[model samples]
Target: MDIFEKVKEIVSEKLHISPERITLESNFKKDFEADSIDLFELVMTMEEAFDVELDDDAVVGIETVADVVHYLQEKM
Candidate 1:
């Protein structure tokens, strides 16, 4: 799967939501109602899935699904 699809899958599983509900513009806090713990867990899961290390500073700026996809794309 592409980065976006993979991200949606991860987010879906982590948040217990349908992948269809996720979009590039979806915000973790506003859209998913995800708190810091949720975002942290999602980031950890993404790190494992994509095999990339993400610094806390880098992760802080990733508020949207598109941000995660772009970060992974740039990292990879």
Candidate 2:
């Protein structure tokens, strides 16, 4: 799957939301009501699934689903 598809899968599974609800414009906090812990778990799960290390500082700017996809695409 592509980066967006992969990210959508991970976020949907972690947040227990419908994959259809997760779009490029979807915000983790505003759209999904994700707390810090939820974001953390999502990041960690993405790291494991994508086989990459996400720096704490780097994760700060990741507010939307597209942000995560872009970040992971760059890293991978």
Candidate 3:
């Protein structure tokens, strides 16, 4: 699957939410109600899935699904 699809899958699995509900504009904290720990776990999942090192500072700027997708795309 592509990075966007993989991201949606990871977010859906971690947040226990449907993939359809996770849109580009959906904010991790506001839309999915993810806390700091949730975000951290999500980042770790992405790191493992993509085999890349995502810095804590970069993760901090990820607010929406689009943000994560864009970041992963750039990193990859």
lDDT: which candidate is best? 1
lDDT of each: 0.94, 0.94, 0.93
- Model 2, span 44-65: residue lDDT tens: 9999999999989999989999
In Å, residue 60's CA in model 1 sits off its true spot by 0.6
Alpha-carbon lDDT of model 2: 0.94
Candidate 3: which pairs clash?
none
Kindly give the stretch of ten consecutive residues in candidate 1 with the minimal lDDT sum. 12-21
Per-residue CA lDDT of candidate 1, range 1-76, in tens?
8999999999999999898889999999999999999999999999999999998899999999999999999999
Please give the clash total of every predicted structure, in order. 0, 0, 0
Q: Residue 38 deviation, candidate 2, in Å? A: 0.1
Model 2 ranges off by over 4 Å: none
Candidate 3 has a TM-score of 0.96
User: What ranges in model 1 sit over 4 Å off?
Assistant: none
Sorted on lDDT, best first, the list reads 1, 2, 3
Q: Please, what is the TM-score per model?
A: 0.97, 0.97, 0.96
